[model samples]
Target: MSLTLYALGVAVLLSASFFYLFGYRSWRRRRVMAKPFPADWQTILDRDVWVYRHLPEPLQARLRPLIQVFLDEKRFYGCAGLTVTDTMRVTIAAEACLLILNLPLSFYDDLRAILVYPSAYRVPDIHREGEVLSESSGVHLGDSWQRGKVILSWEDVVAGAGHHQHGHNVAIHEFTHQLDQADGSADGAPMLRSSNALRTWSQVFSKAFDNLQKTLEQGHSELIDPYGATNPAEFFAVVTETFFERPRALHREHPALYRQLQQFFDLDPLSWTRAGD
Candidate 1:
Protein backbone atom coordinates (compact mmCIF):
# COMPACT_ATOMS: atom_id res chain seq x y z
CA MET A 1 0.00 0.00 0.00
CA SER A 2 2.82 2.40 0.85
CA LEU A 3 4.59 1.69 -2.47
CA THR A 4 1.36 2.14 -4.41
CA LEU A 5 0.66 5.50 -2.73
CA TYR A 6 4.22 6.68 -3.52
CA ALA A 7 3.83 5.66 -7.18
CA LEU A 8 0.51 7.49 -7.46
CA GLY A 9 2.03 10.70 -6.12
CA VAL A 10 4.93 10.50 -8.57
CA ALA A 11 2.56 9.95 -11.51
CA VAL A 12 0.50 12.99 -10.53
CA LEU A 13 3.60 15.15 -10.28
CA LEU A 14 4.86 13.96 -13.67
CA SER A 15 1.52 14.73 -15.31
CA ALA A 16 1.43 18.24 -13.81
CA SER A 17 4.97 18.92 -15.02
CA PHE A 18 4.16 17.71 -18.52
CA PHE A 19 1.10 19.97 -18.74
CA TYR A 20 3.03 22.99 -17.53
CA LEU A 21 5.85 22.42 -19.98
CA PHE A 22 3.49 21.90 -22.88
CA GLY A 23 1.50 25.03 -22.14
CA TYR A 24 4.60 27.19 -21.84
CA ARG A 25 6.07 25.82 -25.08
CA SER A 26 2.83 26.51 -26.92
CA TRP A 27 2.73 30.08 -25.68
CA ARG A 28 6.35 30.72 -26.64
CA ARG A 29 5.84 29.30 -30.11
CA ARG A 30 2.84 31.53 -30.74
CA ARG A 31 4.76 34.57 -29.61
CA VAL A 32 7.66 33.76 -31.87
CA MET A 33 5.41 33.19 -34.87
CA ALA A 34 3.74 36.58 -34.58
CA LYS A 35 5.32 38.33 -37.51
CA PRO A 36 6.34 41.98 -37.73
CA PHE A 37 5.06 43.89 -40.77
CA PRO A 38 7.46 43.31 -43.70
CA ALA A 39 9.90 45.89 -45.07
CA ASP A 40 8.68 46.24 -48.69
CA TRP A 41 5.08 46.87 -47.68
CA GLN A 42 5.29 50.62 -48.41
CA THR A 43 5.20 49.99 -52.18
CA ILE A 44 1.65 48.78 -51.77
CA LEU A 45 0.45 51.08 -48.97
CA ASP A 46 1.63 54.25 -50.75
CA ARG A 47 -1.38 54.03 -53.05
CA ASP A 48 -3.27 56.42 -50.80
CA VAL A 49 -1.52 59.75 -51.22
CA TRP A 50 -3.49 61.57 -48.56
CA VAL A 51 -2.79 59.06 -45.84
CA TYR A 52 0.78 58.62 -46.99
CA ARG A 53 1.38 62.38 -46.88
CA HIS A 54 0.19 62.78 -43.29
CA LEU A 55 2.27 60.01 -41.78
CA PRO A 56 5.55 61.00 -40.15
CA GLU A 57 8.61 59.42 -41.78
CA PRO A 58 9.52 57.15 -38.85
CA LEU A 59 5.91 56.08 -38.43
CA GLN A 60 5.60 55.51 -42.14
CA ALA A 61 8.59 53.21 -42.11
CA ARG A 62 7.24 51.16 -39.20
CA LEU A 63 3.70 51.02 -40.55
CA ARG A 64 4.49 49.91 -44.09
CA PRO A 65 4.89 46.23 -43.38
CA LEU A 66 1.99 46.11 -40.94
CA ILE A 67 -0.23 47.77 -43.50
CA GLN A 68 0.90 45.31 -46.12
CA VAL A 69 0.05 42.36 -43.88
CA PHE A 70 -3.36 43.87 -43.21
CA LEU A 71 -4.10 44.37 -46.90
CA ASP A 72 -2.88 40.95 -47.87
CA GLU A 73 -4.51 38.94 -45.08
CA LYS A 74 -7.77 40.74 -44.41
CA ARG A 75 -10.82 40.60 -46.62
CA PHE A 76 -12.55 43.91 -47.35
CA TYR A 77 -16.12 43.61 -48.66
CA GLY A 78 -18.41 46.39 -49.87
CA CYS A 79 -21.88 46.60 -48.38
CA ALA A 80 -24.87 48.88 -48.89
CA GLY A 81 -23.80 49.57 -52.48
CA LEU A 82 -20.33 50.72 -51.45
CA THR A 83 -17.17 50.03 -53.43
CA VAL A 84 -13.62 49.35 -52.29
CA THR A 85 -10.78 51.35 -53.77
CA ASP A 86 -7.04 51.57 -53.33
CA THR A 87 -7.62 54.87 -51.55
CA MET A 88 -10.13 53.29 -49.18
CA ARG A 89 -7.91 50.33 -48.43
CA VAL A 90 -4.87 52.51 -47.81
CA THR A 91 -6.82 54.86 -45.59
CA ILE A 92 -8.23 52.05 -43.48
CA ALA A 93 -4.83 50.40 -43.20
CA ALA A 94 -3.25 53.67 -42.09
CA GLU A 95 -5.77 54.19 -39.31
CA ALA A 96 -5.38 50.62 -38.05
CA CYS A 97 -1.59 50.80 -38.21
CA LEU A 98 -1.57 53.96 -36.11
CA LEU A 99 -2.65 51.90 -33.10
CA ILE A 100 0.26 49.47 -33.49
CA LEU A 101 3.02 51.96 -34.19
CA ASN A 102 5.44 52.68 -31.32
CA LEU A 103 4.00 49.75 -29.39
CA PRO A 104 4.86 46.08 -29.39
CA LEU A 105 3.88 45.24 -32.96
CA SER A 106 3.11 41.72 -31.83
CA PHE A 107 0.50 42.92 -29.37
CA TYR A 108 -2.01 42.22 -32.10
CA ASP A 109 -0.68 38.72 -32.78
CA ASP A 110 -4.05 37.11 -32.15
CA LEU A 111 -6.02 39.50 -34.37
CA ARG A 112 -6.51 37.49 -37.53
CA ALA A 113 -8.63 39.71 -39.80
CA ILE A 114 -10.73 42.83 -40.24
CA LEU A 115 -14.16 43.10 -41.87
CA VAL A 116 -15.54 46.37 -43.12
CA TYR A 117 -19.07 47.30 -44.08
CA PRO A 118 -20.26 50.35 -45.98
CA SER A 119 -22.11 51.94 -43.07
CA ALA A 120 -23.71 51.20 -39.76
CA TYR A 121 -25.14 47.68 -40.06
CA ARG A 122 -27.97 46.08 -38.21
CA VAL A 123 -27.32 42.82 -36.35
CA PRO A 124 -29.93 40.10 -36.39
CA ASP A 125 -32.36 39.63 -33.55
CA ILE A 126 -33.32 36.33 -31.90
CA HIS A 127 -36.76 34.97 -31.13
CA ARG A 128 -37.10 33.67 -27.60
CA GLU A 129 -39.97 31.81 -25.98
CA GLY A 130 -42.78 33.22 -28.22
CA GLU A 131 -41.52 36.72 -27.59
CA VAL A 132 -39.70 38.50 -30.40
CA LEU A 133 -36.72 40.05 -28.67
CA SER A 134 -33.88 42.04 -30.10
CA GLU A 135 -31.09 39.57 -29.51
CA SER A 136 -27.55 40.43 -30.63
CA SER A 137 -29.13 43.62 -31.94
CA GLY A 138 -27.29 46.89 -32.19
CA VAL A 139 -26.59 49.50 -34.83
CA HIS A 140 -22.82 48.96 -34.90
CA LEU A 141 -20.34 51.15 -36.64
CA GLY A 142 -17.49 48.97 -35.41
CA ASP A 143 -16.78 46.01 -33.16
CA SER A 144 -13.79 43.90 -32.05
CA TRP A 145 -14.50 40.45 -30.79
CA GLN A 146 -12.26 37.95 -28.99
CA ARG A 147 -12.42 35.61 -31.94
CA GLY A 148 -9.64 37.38 -33.84
CA LYS A 149 -11.88 39.55 -36.01
CA VAL A 150 -12.67 43.27 -36.16
CA ILE A 151 -15.70 44.78 -37.95
CA LEU A 152 -16.04 48.36 -39.07
CA SER A 153 -18.21 50.60 -41.19
CA TRP A 154 -16.32 52.44 -43.90
CA GLU A 155 -18.36 55.61 -43.43
CA ASP A 156 -17.41 55.80 -39.77
CA VAL A 157 -13.80 55.09 -40.66
CA VAL A 158 -13.72 57.95 -43.16
CA ALA A 159 -15.45 60.30 -40.76
CA GLY A 160 -13.02 59.38 -37.99
CA ALA A 161 -10.01 59.75 -40.27
CA GLY A 162 -11.19 63.21 -41.34
CA HIS A 163 -13.01 64.75 -38.38
CA HIS A 164 -11.25 63.04 -35.42
CA GLN A 165 -13.82 64.65 -33.12
CA HIS A 166 -17.57 64.44 -32.55
CA GLY A 167 -16.74 61.40 -30.41
CA HIS A 168 -17.72 58.73 -32.94
CA ASN A 169 -14.73 57.12 -34.63
CA VAL A 170 -15.33 53.42 -34.94
CA ALA A 171 -11.68 52.73 -35.72
CA ILE A 172 -10.35 54.21 -32.52
CA HIS A 173 -13.09 52.56 -30.49
CA GLU A 174 -12.53 49.10 -31.93
CA PHE A 175 -8.72 49.28 -31.89
CA THR A 176 -8.86 50.33 -28.29
CA HIS A 177 -10.80 47.16 -27.69
CA GLN A 178 -7.99 45.28 -29.40
CA LEU A 179 -5.43 46.86 -27.12
CA ASP A 180 -7.53 45.96 -24.10
CA GLN A 181 -7.65 42.39 -25.36
CA ALA A 182 -3.87 42.10 -25.71
CA ASP A 183 -3.63 40.94 -22.14
CA GLY A 184 -6.44 38.44 -22.83
CA SER A 185 -9.51 40.42 -21.77
CA ALA A 186 -11.44 43.55 -22.82
CA ASP A 187 -11.91 45.08 -19.37
CA GLY A 188 -10.92 48.62 -20.39
CA ALA A 189 -7.42 48.21 -18.94
CA PRO A 190 -4.30 47.27 -20.86
CA MET A 191 -1.11 45.76 -19.51
CA LEU A 192 0.94 48.33 -17.61
CA ARG A 193 4.70 48.59 -17.31
CA SER A 194 4.78 48.53 -13.56
CA SER A 195 2.56 48.03 -10.55
CA ASN A 196 2.83 51.70 -9.61
CA ALA A 197 1.91 52.79 -13.10
CA LEU A 198 -1.02 50.41 -13.01
CA ARG A 199 -2.21 51.91 -9.75
CA THR A 200 -2.04 55.44 -11.08
CA TRP A 201 -3.74 54.43 -14.30
CA SER A 202 -6.57 52.80 -12.41
CA GLN A 203 -7.04 55.82 -10.14
CA VAL A 204 -7.07 58.38 -12.93
CA PHE A 205 -9.28 56.35 -15.26
CA SER A 206 -11.69 55.45 -12.46
CA LYS A 207 -12.06 59.06 -11.40
CA ALA A 208 -12.61 60.21 -14.94
CA PHE A 209 -14.99 57.35 -15.69
CA ASP A 210 -17.06 58.10 -12.59
CA ASN A 211 -17.14 61.79 -13.42
CA LEU A 212 -18.31 61.11 -16.94
CA GLN A 213 -21.06 58.82 -15.65
CA LYS A 214 -22.20 61.50 -13.24
CA THR A 215 -22.29 64.13 -15.96
CA LEU A 216 -24.34 61.84 -18.16
CA GLU A 217 -26.80 61.10 -15.36
CA GLN A 218 -27.18 64.83 -14.73
CA GLY A 219 -27.73 65.51 -18.43
CA HIS A 220 -25.18 68.29 -18.49
CA SER A 221 -23.10 69.51 -21.37
CA GLU A 222 -20.00 67.36 -21.59
CA LEU A 223 -16.72 67.58 -23.36
CA ILE A 224 -16.81 63.85 -24.17
CA ASP A 225 -19.55 61.71 -25.70
CA PRO A 226 -22.12 60.55 -23.16
CA TYR A 227 -21.89 57.05 -24.59
CA GLY A 228 -18.49 56.80 -22.95
CA ALA A 229 -20.26 56.73 -19.63
CA THR A 230 -21.68 53.38 -20.63
CA ASN A 231 -18.54 51.54 -19.46
CA PRO A 232 -14.89 51.92 -18.61
CA ALA A 233 -13.74 50.40 -21.89
CA GLU A 234 -15.91 52.76 -23.91
CA PHE A 235 -14.72 55.63 -21.73
CA PHE A 236 -11.08 54.88 -22.60
CA ALA A 237 -11.78 54.56 -26.32
CA VAL A 238 -13.99 57.68 -26.50
CA VAL A 239 -11.49 59.79 -24.59
CA THR A 240 -8.73 58.45 -26.87
CA GLU A 241 -10.47 59.91 -29.97
CA THR A 242 -11.00 63.21 -28.19
CA PHE A 243 -7.39 63.19 -27.07
CA PHE A 244 -6.24 62.89 -30.66
CA GLU A 245 -8.96 64.79 -32.57
CA ARG A 246 -9.91 67.60 -30.20
CA PRO A 247 -6.82 67.94 -28.07
CA ARG A 248 -7.41 71.53 -27.07
CA ALA A 249 -10.91 70.85 -25.92
CA LEU A 250 -9.87 67.75 -24.04
CA HIS A 251 -7.05 69.61 -22.32
CA ARG A 252 -9.19 72.60 -21.43
CA GLU A 253 -12.13 70.58 -20.15
CA HIS A 254 -10.39 67.66 -18.46
CA PRO A 255 -6.77 68.53 -17.89
CA ALA A 256 -6.03 65.67 -15.51
CA LEU A 257 -7.61 63.08 -17.71
CA TYR A 258 -5.86 64.56 -20.69
CA ARG A 259 -2.53 64.38 -18.94
CA GLN A 260 -3.09 60.76 -18.03
CA LEU A 261 -3.96 59.93 -21.61
CA GLN A 262 -0.90 61.76 -22.86
CA GLN A 263 1.22 59.65 -20.56
CA PHE A 264 -0.55 56.49 -21.63
CA PHE A 265 -0.23 57.08 -25.36
CA ASP A 266 3.22 58.70 -24.99
CA LEU A 267 2.21 61.26 -27.58
CA ASP A 268 1.31 64.87 -26.93
CA PRO A 269 -1.34 65.65 -29.51
CA LEU A 270 -2.07 68.96 -27.79
CA SER A 271 1.43 70.10 -28.56
CA TRP A 272 1.22 68.68 -32.05
CA THR A 273 -2.06 70.52 -32.70
CA ARG A 274 -0.71 73.69 -31.18
CA ALA A 275 2.33 73.56 -33.41
CA GLY A 276 0.15 72.93 -36.44
CA ASP A 277 -2.15 75.77 -35.44
Candidate 2:
Protein backbone atom coordinates (compact mmCIF):
# COMPACT_ATOMS: atom_id res chain seq x y z
CA MET A 1 0.00 0.00 0.00
CA SER A 2 2.85 2.42 0.86
CA LEU A 3 4.61 1.76 -2.46
CA THR A 4 1.42 2.34 -4.41
CA LEU A 5 0.81 5.71 -2.67
CA TYR A 6 4.38 6.89 -3.42
CA ALA A 7 4.01 5.97 -7.13
CA LEU A 8 0.69 7.81 -7.38
CA GLY A 9 2.24 10.93 -5.84
CA VAL A 10 5.11 10.81 -8.35
CA ALA A 11 2.68 10.52 -11.25
CA VAL A 12 0.70 13.53 -10.00
CA LEU A 13 3.89 15.58 -9.70
CA LEU A 14 4.93 14.68 -13.25
CA SER A 15 1.55 15.66 -14.61
CA ALA A 16 1.63 19.02 -12.86
CA SER A 17 5.14 19.68 -14.17
CA PHE A 18 4.03 18.97 -17.73
CA PHE A 19 1.11 21.41 -17.48
CA TYR A 20 3.34 24.10 -16.03
CA LEU A 21 5.91 23.72 -18.81
CA PHE A 22 3.20 23.79 -21.46
CA GLY A 23 1.63 26.95 -20.06
CA TYR A 24 5.00 28.67 -19.76
CA ARG A 25 5.94 27.75 -23.32
CA SER A 26 2.64 29.03 -24.65
CA TRP A 27 3.05 32.34 -22.84
CA ARG A 28 6.61 32.74 -24.14
CA ARG A 29 5.47 32.13 -27.73
CA ARG A 30 2.74 34.71 -27.44
CA ARG A 31 5.16 37.27 -26.00
CA VAL A 32 7.67 36.69 -28.80
CA MET A 33 4.97 36.97 -31.50
CA ALA A 34 3.80 40.28 -30.02
CA LYS A 35 7.17 41.95 -30.65
CA PRO A 36 7.05 42.32 -34.43
CA PHE A 37 4.54 44.76 -35.84
CA PRO A 38 2.78 43.73 -39.06
CA ALA A 39 4.14 44.72 -42.46
CA ASP A 40 2.20 47.12 -44.77
CA TRP A 41 1.27 49.11 -41.66
CA GLN A 42 3.31 52.10 -42.83
CA THR A 43 0.56 52.94 -45.31
CA ILE A 44 -1.83 53.59 -42.45
CA LEU A 45 0.75 55.67 -40.58
CA ASP A 46 1.62 57.78 -43.64
CA ARG A 47 -1.92 59.16 -43.79
CA ASP A 48 -1.04 61.64 -41.04
CA VAL A 49 0.63 64.75 -42.47
CA TRP A 50 0.81 66.73 -39.26
CA VAL A 51 2.78 64.12 -37.35
CA TYR A 52 5.12 63.70 -40.30
CA ARG A 53 5.70 67.46 -40.43
CA HIS A 54 6.00 68.33 -36.75
CA LEU A 55 8.20 65.53 -35.39
CA PRO A 56 11.96 65.73 -36.06
CA GLU A 57 13.39 63.63 -38.89
CA PRO A 58 15.09 61.06 -36.67
CA LEU A 59 12.06 60.83 -34.39
CA GLN A 60 9.74 60.48 -37.36
CA ALA A 61 11.73 57.58 -38.70
CA ARG A 62 11.61 55.78 -35.36
CA LEU A 63 7.95 56.65 -34.78
CA ARG A 64 6.57 55.40 -38.08
CA PRO A 65 6.96 51.69 -37.34
CA LEU A 66 5.94 52.01 -33.70
CA ILE A 67 2.79 53.88 -34.69
CA GLN A 68 2.06 51.17 -37.20
CA VAL A 69 2.02 48.55 -34.45
CA PHE A 70 -0.33 50.74 -32.45
CA LEU A 71 -2.68 51.03 -35.42
CA ASP A 72 -2.63 47.33 -36.21
CA GLU A 73 -3.35 45.60 -32.92
CA LYS A 74 -4.77 48.23 -30.58
CA ARG A 75 -8.58 48.43 -30.42
CA PHE A 76 -10.24 51.89 -30.38
CA TYR A 77 -13.67 52.88 -29.14
CA GLY A 78 -15.84 56.01 -29.18
CA CYS A 79 -18.07 56.72 -26.23
CA ALA A 80 -20.39 59.45 -24.96
CA GLY A 81 -21.41 60.41 -28.51
CA LEU A 82 -17.83 60.59 -29.65
CA THR A 83 -16.81 59.92 -33.22
CA VAL A 84 -13.33 58.64 -33.97
CA THR A 85 -11.84 60.58 -36.85
CA ASP A 86 -8.73 59.91 -38.91
CA THR A 87 -7.07 63.07 -37.62
CA MET A 88 -7.76 62.14 -34.01
CA ARG A 89 -6.33 58.68 -34.53
CA VAL A 90 -3.17 60.09 -36.05
CA THR A 91 -2.69 62.61 -33.27
CA ILE A 92 -3.03 60.03 -30.51
CA ALA A 93 -0.74 57.59 -32.30
CA ALA A 94 1.90 60.26 -32.83
CA GLU A 95 1.95 61.27 -29.18
CA ALA A 96 2.10 57.66 -27.98
CA CYS A 97 4.87 56.77 -30.42
CA LEU A 98 6.99 59.59 -29.03
CA LEU A 99 7.23 57.76 -25.70
CA ILE A 100 8.78 54.61 -27.20
CA LEU A 101 10.71 56.21 -30.10
CA ASN A 102 14.11 55.90 -28.46
CA LEU A 103 13.54 52.58 -26.70
CA PRO A 104 12.72 49.05 -27.73
CA LEU A 105 9.49 48.96 -29.72
CA SER A 106 8.23 46.06 -27.64
CA PHE A 107 7.90 48.21 -24.53
CA TYR A 108 4.27 48.77 -25.44
CA ASP A 109 3.52 45.20 -26.40
CA ASP A 110 0.88 44.81 -23.73
CA LEU A 111 -1.21 47.73 -24.98
CA ARG A 112 -4.21 46.34 -26.84
CA ALA A 113 -6.88 49.03 -27.00
CA ILE A 114 -7.73 52.74 -26.90
CA LEU A 115 -11.15 54.15 -25.86
CA VAL A 116 -12.04 57.75 -26.71
CA TYR A 117 -14.85 59.88 -25.36
CA PRO A 118 -16.29 63.03 -26.96
CA SER A 119 -15.53 64.99 -23.82
CA ALA A 120 -14.86 64.32 -20.18
CA TYR A 121 -17.31 61.58 -19.26
CA ARG A 122 -18.20 60.37 -15.81
CA VAL A 123 -17.28 56.87 -14.65
CA PRO A 124 -20.12 55.75 -12.43
CA ASP A 125 -19.80 53.10 -9.70
CA ILE A 126 -16.02 52.91 -9.33
CA HIS A 127 -16.64 51.61 -5.81
CA ARG A 128 -19.67 50.05 -4.21
CA GLU A 129 -20.95 51.97 -1.17
CA GLY A 130 -24.09 49.85 -0.62
CA GLU A 131 -26.10 52.95 -1.58
CA VAL A 132 -24.45 53.41 -4.97
CA LEU A 133 -22.52 56.45 -3.87
CA SER A 134 -20.87 58.53 -6.60
CA GLU A 135 -17.75 59.18 -4.59
CA SER A 136 -15.13 59.63 -7.36
CA SER A 137 -16.76 62.05 -9.77
CA GLY A 138 -14.83 64.19 -12.22
CA VAL A 139 -14.36 64.95 -15.90
CA HIS A 140 -11.30 62.95 -16.82
CA LEU A 141 -9.41 63.97 -19.92
CA GLY A 142 -7.68 60.62 -20.19
CA ASP A 143 -6.90 57.45 -18.27
CA SER A 144 -4.67 54.39 -18.79
CA TRP A 145 -5.44 50.99 -17.31
CA GLN A 146 -3.07 48.24 -16.27
CA ARG A 147 -4.96 45.78 -18.45
CA GLY A 148 -4.04 47.47 -21.78
CA LYS A 149 -6.77 50.04 -22.43
CA VAL A 150 -6.19 53.80 -22.81
CA ILE A 151 -9.15 56.17 -22.46
CA LEU A 152 -9.19 59.70 -23.82
CA SER A 153 -11.46 62.64 -24.41
CA TRP A 154 -11.27 63.78 -28.04
CA GLU A 155 -11.86 67.43 -27.23
CA ASP A 156 -9.10 67.51 -24.65
CA VAL A 157 -6.77 65.66 -26.99
CA VAL A 158 -7.20 68.13 -29.82
CA ALA A 159 -6.92 71.12 -27.55
CA GLY A 160 -3.78 69.77 -25.91
CA ALA A 161 -2.17 68.99 -29.26
CA GLY A 162 -2.99 72.42 -30.68
CA HIS A 163 -1.81 74.43 -27.69
CA HIS A 164 1.80 73.64 -26.85
CA GLN A 165 2.09 75.97 -23.85
CA HIS A 166 -0.90 74.69 -21.90
CA GLY A 167 1.07 71.84 -20.32
CA HIS A 168 -1.83 69.47 -20.92
CA ASN A 169 -1.97 66.64 -23.47
CA VAL A 170 -4.24 63.73 -22.73
CA ALA A 171 -2.49 61.40 -25.12
CA ILE A 172 0.98 62.07 -23.76
CA HIS A 173 -0.19 61.98 -20.18
CA GLU A 174 -2.06 58.66 -20.45
CA PHE A 175 0.68 56.99 -22.48
CA THR A 176 3.24 58.13 -19.93
CA HIS A 177 1.13 56.31 -17.36
CA GLN A 178 1.29 53.25 -19.57
CA LEU A 179 5.07 53.45 -19.61
CA ASP A 180 5.11 53.68 -15.85
CA GLN A 181 2.75 50.72 -15.65
CA ALA A 182 4.98 48.59 -17.87
CA ASP A 183 6.89 47.46 -14.80
CA GLY A 184 3.63 46.25 -13.18
CA SER A 185 3.29 49.36 -10.97
CA ALA A 186 2.52 53.00 -11.76
CA ASP A 187 5.10 54.48 -9.44
CA GLY A 188 6.93 57.53 -10.74
CA ALA A 189 9.84 55.67 -12.38
CA PRO A 190 9.63 53.57 -15.54
CA MET A 191 12.00 50.90 -16.77
CA LEU A 192 15.51 52.30 -17.30
CA ARG A 193 18.45 50.68 -19.09
CA SER A 194 21.23 51.03 -16.57
CA SER A 195 21.80 51.22 -12.85
CA ASN A 196 23.51 54.60 -13.17
CA ALA A 197 20.54 55.96 -15.06
CA LEU A 198 18.15 54.64 -12.43
CA ARG A 199 20.14 56.22 -9.62
CA THR A 200 20.30 59.60 -11.29
CA TRP A 201 16.63 59.42 -12.20
CA SER A 202 15.54 58.65 -8.63
CA GLN A 203 17.68 61.41 -7.13
CA VAL A 204 16.57 64.10 -9.56
CA PHE A 205 12.91 63.15 -9.56
CA SER A 206 12.76 62.89 -5.76
CA LYS A 207 14.16 66.37 -5.29
CA ALA A 208 11.94 67.87 -7.94
CA PHE A 209 8.86 66.12 -6.60
CA ASP A 210 9.53 67.38 -3.09
CA ASN A 211 10.04 70.93 -4.31
CA LEU A 212 6.85 70.84 -6.38
CA GLN A 213 4.89 69.61 -3.38
CA LYS A 214 6.28 72.39 -1.24
CA THR A 215 5.48 75.01 -3.87
CA LEU A 216 1.90 73.81 -4.03
CA GLU A 217 1.59 73.80 -0.25
CA GLN A 218 2.85 77.39 -0.16
CA GLY A 219 0.02 78.41 -2.54
CA HIS A 220 2.47 79.78 -5.07
CA SER A 221 1.97 79.84 -8.77
CA GLU A 222 4.64 77.72 -10.41
CA LEU A 223 6.08 77.92 -13.90
CA ILE A 224 5.03 74.36 -14.55
CA ASP A 225 1.40 73.43 -14.14
CA PRO A 226 0.07 73.12 -10.60
CA TYR A 227 -1.60 69.85 -11.60
CA GLY A 228 1.88 68.32 -11.54
CA ALA A 229 1.77 68.68 -7.80
CA THR A 230 -0.91 66.03 -7.65
CA ASN A 231 1.65 63.25 -7.19
CA PRO A 232 4.89 61.78 -8.51
CA ALA A 233 3.29 60.05 -11.50
CA GLU A 234 1.33 63.14 -12.54
CA PHE A 235 4.41 65.26 -11.99
CA PHE A 236 6.42 63.12 -14.40
CA ALA A 237 3.69 63.26 -17.02
CA VAL A 238 3.16 67.01 -16.60
CA VAL A 239 6.87 67.78 -16.75
CA THR A 240 7.17 65.65 -19.88
CA GLU A 241 4.61 67.84 -21.63
CA THR A 242 6.49 70.96 -20.56
CA PHE A 243 9.81 69.42 -21.61
CA PHE A 244 8.51 69.00 -25.13
CA GLU A 245 6.16 71.96 -25.34
CA ARG A 246 7.95 74.66 -23.36
CA PRO A 247 11.56 73.50 -23.43
CA ARG A 248 13.16 76.93 -23.27
CA ALA A 249 11.22 77.99 -20.23
CA LEU A 250 11.74 74.64 -18.48
CA HIS A 251 15.46 74.80 -19.14
CA ARG A 252 15.71 78.38 -17.95
CA GLU A 253 13.79 77.78 -14.73
CA HIS A 254 14.66 74.17 -13.86
CA PRO A 255 17.99 73.42 -15.48
CA ALA A 256 18.80 70.31 -13.45
CA LEU A 257 15.34 68.87 -13.96
CA TYR A 258 15.61 69.50 -17.67
CA ARG A 259 19.01 67.79 -17.77
CA GLN A 260 17.56 64.73 -16.01
CA LEU A 261 14.77 64.50 -18.54
CA GLN A 262 17.27 64.92 -21.38
CA GLN A 263 19.25 61.95 -20.09
CA PHE A 264 16.11 59.82 -19.61
CA PHE A 265 14.48 60.60 -22.96
CA ASP A 266 17.84 60.83 -24.84
CA LEU A 267 16.61 63.79 -26.88
CA ASP A 268 16.80 67.55 -26.51
CA PRO A 269 13.40 69.10 -27.14
CA LEU A 270 14.96 72.48 -26.44
CA SER A 271 16.96 72.04 -29.62
CA TRP A 272 13.90 70.92 -31.55
CA THR A 273 11.81 73.82 -30.25
CA ARG A 274 14.59 76.35 -30.96
CA ALA A 275 15.15 75.16 -34.53
CA GLY A 276 11.64 76.08 -35.63
CA ASP A 277 10.59 76.35 -39.21
Assess each prediction's global lDDT (C-alpha) against the native. 0.72, 0.75
lDDT of 2 by residue, 240-270 (tens): 8788777788888899889988877777776
Q: What is the lDDT of residue 70 in candidate 2?
A: 63
The clash tally of candidate 2 reads 0
Per lDDT, the best of the predicted structures is 2
Off by over 4 Å in 1: 1-56, 72-83, 125-136, 275-277
Candidate 2 minimal-lDDT segment of 10 residues: 42-51
| Residues forming the 10-long window of minimal summed lDDT in candidate 1 | 41-50
Clashes of 1: 0
